[model samples]
Target chain A: MPASASSIPDTVLVSADALHALAVRVLLRLGLSQAHAEAMARTIVAGQRDDCQSHGVYRLLTCAQTVRSGKVELQAEPVVAPTRGAVVRVDARRGFSPLAFERGLPALVEAARTQGLAALAIHQCFHFSALWPEIEALTAHGLAALALTPSHAWVAPAGGHRPVFGTNPIAFGWPRPGPYPFVFDFATSAIARGDLELHRRAGTPLPAGCGVDAQGRPSTDPLAVAQGAMLAFGGHKGSALAAMVELMAGALIGDWTSQESLEFDAGAQAAPCHGELVLAFDPARLAGGDPAAGQQSAERLFQAITDQGARLPSQRRYAARERSLQRGIAVPRALYEEIEALGG
Target chain B: MPASASSIPDTVLVSADALHALAVRVLLRLGLSQAHAEAMARTIVAGQRDDCQSHGVYRLLTCAQTVRSGKVELQAEPVVAPTRGAVVRVDARRGFSPLAFERGLPALVEAARTQGLAALAIHQCFHFSALWPEIEALTAHGLAALALTPSHAWVAPAGGHRPVFGTNPIAFGWPRPGPYPFVFDFATSAIARGDLELHRRAGTPLPAGCGVDAQGRPSTDPLAVAQGAMLAFGGHKGSALAAMVELMAGALIGDWTSQESLEFDAGAQAAPCHGELVLAFDPARLAGGDPAAGQQSAERLFQAITDQGARLPSQRRYAARERSLQRGIAVPRALYEEIEALGG
Candidate 1:
């Protein structure tokens, strides 16, 4: 193990490097190839570095279980098709999505850089991360990016009584000449599935607008809504957007919809095997003028937002990232121990 | 001036062709060239044909006033830039967007067909129509499309009190092997600006989530919110989307942001002169497989939605379109007379 900070009974502070190396070791022991282990570890460490604990090291439990059950293609290599204009296709070969995205980002970035716009379609993969990481990666290349994917059938369309859509998420990133780019990743559903699970684990009532009971009636019980259907945010409009995600990421790519993905999950222990769509736009190409002027123009809008007392969407996450960089991430002692013991 | 169904005290029926011609005549009388008048008329006819009263002939009232103020470049022609890779641009020359969109569609369709994906950015335009017409037009060509544009500054961001964003609208279309495509066009705001005006005229209270007063307190008064701030739909998520529109359509295209557009409006009578962004994706190029097979796969998801007894968005509009085809459109006599008297 690498260096770590002093620990307490309930919380353990670990350096980002140590946390990443530990995650890689655990994944390697659990059956992932070294290449995939490194890729997955980078993603998990990013979640913790940003203080998004739900997607942090806590995910190793599912990874271990899913692999043990022979659900994941532990050694499968992702394949990228030769670029066809502005659309790039990546076949994940029934493995996880992170490695595939990593392999294909170069092609996507190249296409967008030259063509002004490009879309990447990743198929036959179990997507395990929020889209922000992919969006951020594109933003790092000074590209504006939009990403979407459908998960297991856990959310109901607005006005429907059963789950037909996933906790489909849409994420966007706009490049800026600042410390961090403007980014937002959110599920079209009223609440994210991970958040719902945390609420249920704590035996807490859900906030209003979160969900409907099994009978399609409003309910505060996290367990009930978890077993029932998650409502789309903003009612019908959000539902329409969720459906758009299903079509764009799923049908448009000739992959499984959320319903089909859930059916494939069978026992439901594994993450949903699905598809993702990512579109990146280069401001310089689109502006048809000076890219610097475009960036300056965009800054005015951001300044206007902050000046009026409204916080930008990812300010909290960015602040947490700053803090985590200074002091290591603190994790629950019990959860940390569990992750440490995953290889046992 | 033209043949009409015998007028009743409250309503008069007009054939779609007749209605289109009337709209053309009215716009022509207001100084629009014949080509521009015809372009604008088709959009107005489509709205009434779909039973969307808010966007129908009533829009002529605003069009007349706007043109009379010399705010519209009535004879200005749209110029479509030769395709630059997968991006196409149309300079509206300060005219209404309808004629510009008409002139640009062919180039956009060709680019999307050859490149798998394409984006059409229309700049320096006064957009005065709902986006569905543009979306549906693309769907008619067997393509999936999405369009968005910003309007006058009238909406508040989710956490902010003052209005900074527009009633930005997003529209999407998916092609299917059926009479009507899967389509949805909606404002990011809780309620559309036209609907608010209707509520105020009828002296009805605004919907619960519609708006806030000048002090940022929630209010049901249409007039107060109109003078104050209209809320974004779905809270923070919708607000973020609205902001995205501002960047993609405004700054990304090097056009006016909503705030700048409002400042240009000065006394607030002209339609927002900004930019529009439309993205078209070719199912065939992106699928890299059998196009018909992909369409078949998409139909399964649509079937699942209807199987759950949940109505898909735009079903009512399609139904109304069918009715209008058979029985013609019924326009309230008073409003019809108002439109007629404008030409006189």
Candidate 2:
């Protein structure tokens, strides 16, 4: 493989399949089981294909370090409890979450189909992947889905100085008639931890209100925020949402809170071990009128969004996906070389 | 009831029972049926008792006008479809939503108890009350609840200049071992439409980003924003949430979108008649571990929030409630006179 210097500079153009194969080999070499490797690879590839670089191959570095830190059970088998009474439980046994989600998704889809709504709870997993993938999974089954999960405690409550809450992302997906679903995944925090880390690595100043220093004064220094705390987006409202995620995905699910997850990390900065809550709704079953009418109604909302030049939540991602499929993804050549070397 | 002049000035001290009686009488005088009057009265009194002024007796003025406009079914009875497969459906018959919700709460509670999680879809109602009462209803049952509803299209989507979404509110309540359930109900818009109207009436300027002018330029003029569009909180994330509410509470329930609701009003500006979605989760049924452990976990999160000097959402409201219970609510003398005149 060679860098595509013909058009783009310092970028390697690689097919999705080739990237998946490389990711799988890398995961396998790093000690993941076959199922785990494939699930993880698929998620990473999807991130790349969708141009969500934060969740793409950049994640491999942290994952590899996490495995080396003796924190993750790379080959652990996930156990799924049979779906009943609108709840689907999957015990990830302290392993990576992707494999557990894959095992539990079918039962979730079936339950939602039968009951009009269903919940999927995955326990004790390294929940490092973006929630959009999980949400998109349900959307693909023609279901509306909501996904929530806690992360390490690096964000402060709206009016507080200390970090007690996680980035705590909430994701939602609505099924539509076309290839793309109306999708959005956003952190309750002012900014995602990954983006903060990116700024830290590049020695860049954060946007105002992104974080506070150790003394609780607002600061743009990513390093200071890394040492102190990130602020919740939209102030108090976003903070309330973060608390909701913590309570629903953490306490309600009988799992660790962000504070607990951080303590478990012991300063390793590894993937946060926690649980996830995914709720799916079958529109055809849930809607009282004709399902087609509901779908048409959804289409009108989307069209209205575009008509006003307001982009849908995942519009850019879908556009990037199309471009990637046609012209292959553009990965920084240096990063590509580094990822390739990780397989050895 | 005579005005209590011992401590507070320019106020009339009225007991909850007395206030309820007055509100009920006023609602009935406005042509509401007994059941509708009682339900609306209870909600209005609850707001006053909680010190939530926006939802208190101030709402009676609007309720009276709406009834006069023939927009509400003063004597209509809500129909409840029995719980089936985690779904509890209610038809509000174009009446007030409070009564419909009251009718469906029991079925939703039963369904959640049986299925671990359940959804209540209330269709075609004049949803003029605050959502906190509906949320508290579920939390009182030891269930975690999430409620969403769309109002008139007075807000713009993020990045767009046109009004297309509503001041859609998302309310959540989590049960705890305390006097108050952890509760938060906030509009997806930068500020509630009621607050904007208040600012306009008071000749006060709005905070930056609260809304835009008729030309879509950022403006602090509440009247201009009223003529144009209100902005969503936290920018795009809040906008995305507002869209979700429109789809779920509107399209998914086969009811009316904010745009549709606005069009239906035909510039009447009456209460936006639409649907609502309330999802409940029975903690014991949903938890993978001992139910007590889950409860304790929730308690810990609450404690942590307070320990960090951060006040939980609705803390002030709860405190106000305790004060109101001990020493009757203090109503402004002029408003008390106004309400009494309306009842006559």
Candidate 3:
């Protein structure tokens, strides 16, 4: 849907269902419960539909390897603890993050309804997918939500050379009375590591301020940046945001910081266990005693932006989803074969 | 404290108390009540102590003029309405934002303690100061806080020509068990409008991607950018954040959007009325029933960053505050005289 690998002669077209079934079969072979496999497969397919190939089947092989390595507990069930009236904590027991989220989100939404606002902290899980889906799910329940998580270290501080922070991503969702929710997710780094890797694969130069060379000099060479470190986007502002995410997702959740993640990754090839923070706000309770008024306000704001010819965040993803639903997903033939072999 | 205009030879040193008294006197002359004047003056003095010169006395003259022009109600009191168990809405009665915050923050804090999380929305107010102080107040009461506010539109959306978004600022505060809370505040724009005005005054070139020229072309000329529009930081990512802030502070609060503010400002030189959204989280309640564990985790995260020789956000402001507290604030001679004259 988003300019597939047309240059590759071995590109293949597959239906979304087929892709999902293949992913489930491969994950099932690698020792995952039917439910867990189905959950992970749905996320991967959604990523493909939304044009985020890096988060799609591109990571399936690695996911299978990680599970095979036994670093991720195949049979793990999250322990959800409601620590307070509006605070929910989920210990993922070193399992998949999606399952933890699935286990805790309903309770989190319920808490928000009762207390006006609620927070969900998920720790000891491998989160290797796009965050939008999780926040999107909250919006589906007519709530405003924010989600943040830290990954393995790749980004450097604004002025410093070494990588000290993760390419931390933050996502927000606002539910209007309209048909769809307004949502967006982005990494705090100048460029996502996946994009940098794509540039390297294409033999393209990176943009200015994207990353630095080994000598701590700003470089446009993707290889040099890959070898050195990525810079935080927008200089100090992005660095500050990355730091905030570290506090919220890592420290507040009592989970691994970027440094800790790196240390853990040093001894294993599996994805490092991470943490997530999700916040839900009940508009009916917070919007001056009338939720309809709040929804109308959101509608007016969205109209104002669209009137200015300004594209809203996640518009492209939604467009891609529409196209993918009609045309099916495009997968590279080589990758398809690899997945097929894994299924067998 | 922050390398004041000592090179200008006309810089004057003023004690913090004297500065506060002078600001209060000037505002009192402009028809603000004693309580309102004191509240406004405290914010001004705090801005100076923290080295936020643009938010300090530099903007006091404009504020007085706006209030005199009847754009800001001088004697109005904020009306606090508890919409739900943990949500409060403060209609500022078209008065000052600081007063609205002062009126609602106590209830908001109490709600957070009772329910683990709470939100406060303030609308119909003139907000012309740094947001850190309000969030800092929450931290002082041992709460983690987040605040956002929208201003008059000046920034262009990503990949768009015309200005459609405000330089919406977001602030976050984490109250550690340490002596000081970790806090950071930043505008979503590539640079704060105040700093851009400073660059224009100095005839300096803007940084890459800071803004665009009159033709919607990216320009480093501060004057051209002044004539045109500022760009969002980190391109699309920052634009999305600015949009999120517009929704949270503008739509969610049922207040004027940035475009509405601009329309209102079109007929006058007064500062546009804006809105603010503040959220408080009680760490003791939300941090898995063990507040000390949360504190230790935060300390570890901070140490990890410091170990890389990377400076923390607001480290400079904290340092400036220490120096200003010890040696008093520095003011330009002409500005000092202007304030002294206004007080009379």
Candidate 4:
């Protein structure tokens, strides 16, 4: 099939289907179970759907290579069980995150229904792109949710020279009365480490303080940022947030901090250790039988704001989702060519 | 007793007692209940001990004024109950946060034990000082936790002005192998609004792109940052995260967005519509009688990093905590004089 160029200038967009097919093939070729491959592929495709191409098909090659090298186990199955006080812990057994989360969330949901809320700590898992989709699953069931994942590399501690933490993204999803629910997700780093790769490929300059040079001083060179380390967002505050996620996701799950787990040299590999922390709450617990009424109040408040010309959170994304669905999800020729090459 | 004229240097150490006494007096004079005054005072002072001065007694004057204007119902009692799910909600009755949280957390604790994890959402609450302490309370029971709060003002949506959000902050804590567990809390703004206030008072300059003028142009002038609006920490991503908090903390709780909640003038009293989200999980649920073993693994992992001369999250605050406990908490002379002027 002929490839189409991405409409987003400077960005190469690939069709979700093409990306998913390539990702699944790569994962399977790397020895992942068919189910795991499909799940991982879907996750990667979701990232692209949400304009997170850096985490989408772009990551497939690296993920496949990592798995093939045994840096991320492909055959592992998560072992999930109930913990004290409504907590559920999943020993991901060093598998992909979707498998762990899929196994863990049911337990959390069951517990939350009985206990009013629940938490799941999935330890020793591989990456899951775009947390919003993960948390959105819970929000769909009337549960408000938050998720945190600690990465294996690319952040520095405050005032420190060396990279010692992950970008450490936190994501939250809440059901609202709007046409679409509001969701927010972000990394603690000033810029996602994935951007470093894009910058490297495109020969673009990075924003200052996004990362450090070889000497550990701040730099705007993508190569240095990738090789040295990414800086935390908001200086001390961002560092603190990153550090917090390390404790919550890494420490709680008995995984090494991203800094310690990093294998910077291309030939080096990270240990099979990563974790995610998920918390779920049913807002019905707060609104009683009057959720509709409470939502009405919220709608009224936001309507007042809209009356003043303010847009609601996720409004743009909601619009984009509709447009994308209507337009059959556009794919750029450049990204499609890359995917074709990888698949071949 | 005559006030001591001694200076605490870069560290303005004050005894916990003196700080609490002064804080209580100020709140009481501003019309808070004795119990509310005490809780608020302790929570605020606790942040000072943790070196979270921005969220500590530093905001006392604002709270006092907030209470004075009847925006905050000083004696309001929270309404707590379980909803359809095991979830618990606390209506702050438009009161101060410490009191509201003190009322809400117990419900969350009870709910978490049965649910394995539970979330407490407190709505219409005034400012809560330093989210770490609230998470600390959960950790005391050996529970890992996450907490988030929305500030009342001084942040803008990405590429837009008009102070549409606050320096929303998030905190996460985990229990570990020592007397001090890991705790991290920080704002999502490039700089805290309080820092801008400090700059305004001290005649200092802000780092570039910290905020923008009223016309939505970037500025390094602290005064403008205050009167105009601060930018989200990492541009688009940070803005998205803050928007998520708005839904979780504001819309979910039936409050308006920060922009909508603002009263006419920027500095004048705005409607106190802040909300908090808390999640707690017990590690034992997943440990299966091997809590210590899991903790040991986590401890070893953290120790390995520290052995390499890497600092753990909150290490500096823990050090400050010890120093304060041993040397007595310090109070700035100016603050001391200000407290004395309150005739405590």
Highest DockQ, which number? 2
Write the number of the candidate with greater DockQ, choosing between 1 and 3: 1
lDDT of 2 by residue, B1-344 (tens): 55674787777878988999999999999998999889999999999889898899989998877887787888889999867799999999999989999999999999999899999999899997999999999999999999999999889899887898999999999998767999999999999999999999999999999898888899999999999899999999999999999988888877788988888888776899989999999888878778787778678777877887889999999998998989898777778889999999
- How would you encode candidate 2's per-residue C-alpha lDDT over A148-200 as one tens digit per residue? 99998888897788898999999999988668889999999999888998899
Minimum summed lDDT over a 10-residue window in model 2 chain B is located at B1-10
Model 1 root mean square deviation, Cα atoms: 1.9
- The window of 10 residues in a row where model 1 chain A has the poorest summed lDDT is A1-10
Point out where model 1 deviates above 4 Å: A1-9, B1-9
Over the stretch B1-344, how does candidate 3's per-residue lDDT look in tens digits?
Answer: 22345645777777898899999999898898887888889889988878788888876887976876677889998899855767878998888778889989889899888877888989888886788999899999998889998888888888775677889999999987655689999999999887887889899888888898878888989999877889988788899899888878876666767777777777576776878899988877766646677678678777766776878888888898887777778777888888888899
Worst 10 residues of 3 chain B by lDDT: B1-10
Query: Could you give candidate 4's per-residue lDDT for residues A235-283 as a string of tens digits?
Result: 7767777776766666555554564455422455532356787877665
Each prediction's Cα lDDT score? 0.88, 0.90, 0.82, 0.70
**Residue range A188-273, candidate 1, lDDT tens digits:** 99998988988999999999988888998888899999888889999999999999999888887778889889899897568889
Q: At residue B208, give the lDDT of candidate 4.
A: 90
lDDT, candidate 3, at B105? 88
- Candidate 2's displacement at residue B71, Å, is 1.6
DockQ of each: 0.71, 0.79, 0.53, 0.34
Better of 2 and 3 by TM-score: 2
Expressed as tens digits, the lDDT of each residue in B201-291 for candidate 1 is: 9999998989999999999999999888999999999999999988888888778788888888898488889989999999988887777
Model 2 stretches with alpha carbons more than 4 Å out: A2-5
How would you encode candidate 4's per-residue C-alpha lDDT over B232-266 as one tens digit per residue?
Answer: 88676777677666656665554545644564225
